[model samples]
Target: MKYTTMEQLLLTELVGAQVINHGGIKVCLRRSENIPSMGGATFDHVALFVLDGTVVEWIDHLNPWDIKSITSLKGSETNLYGSRGAYGTVLIETK
Candidate 1:
């Protein structure tokens, strides 16, 4: 399947995340309800990476062939990330 950016994100990471699909698709990562709020600044971080695994980087532009593998976690798998998992987490290995 030709994955959209949102689709790739969902596949590569962020399980248990709440997704809203209107026109394209919008992912509002579900943070813990009891953790208070960050006033919409939560998950607003995106760093571009071509290797070394990644977190919410711009993978949309990358050809699917460029991705070697994908693995993720939720509810206490490395917190999700090996170091800092989200409500869910996935690491995309680049080729």
Candidate 2:
């Protein structure tokens, strides 16, 4: 996997995204689209991807031991946790 760059995220407006804790991990959420198209989802997990550019805190949805990862959405292959047309969320935590 490739590490995300500050320029890519910042220029992409993926900063200050949100994240959710599932199975005790924090994962980055992305859009869900069968075809690679623009103007899709608002990114369900921006909070995790932009961690390198900024530090985020969702006290209500994370734990101290939580790790981080780019879990892709099933079928769609997008950087998300759950599946497309379903949850389309992810769970990454601190390793």
Candidate 3:
């Protein structure tokens, strides 16, 4: 399917403005909406991440093997983060 990402992720269900981090840590960008503003949005405006259940400001370093699963939430599904998930939310389950 056509896609976009902090890297790029693949999902048949991914819609317009949707994103996925298919390569490496970029996978955490899943569900990040594509909104090309005048100033452009930063990664923080792309998606909020939950690493091992702890909400982190950013992923400093991540080992592929440490990742157990990756889930993305968008639109109304992101209410849990308040405005943090306005773009989307990436839930990273690590080992």
| Best-matching candidate per lDDT | 3
**Candidate 2 on 1-95: residue-level lDDT in tens?**
22244223222332332333332223343443532334333334333322323334332343333334423233454333232224332333344
Q: Which has the greatest TM-score?
A: 3
TM-score of each: 0.42, 0.23, 0.56
Winner of 2 and 3 under TM-score: 3
- lDDT of all the models against the reference? 0.45, 0.33, 0.54
Clashing pairs in 1: 77-80, 79-85, 81-85
In candidate 1, stretches whose alpha carbon ends up further than 4 angstroms from where it belongs are 1-51, 80-84
Q: Write one digit per residue (lDDT tens) for candidate 3, span 1-95.
A: 33343233323322343333323232223433443322333334556777887878655456444556667787798898888787677777866
Off by over 4 Å in 3: 1-44
> Could you tally the backbone clashes for each prediction?
3, 15, 4
lDDT of 1 by residue, 1-95 (tens): 44545455554455555443333333444455543343333233221232354455344455665666655444555442444343444456766
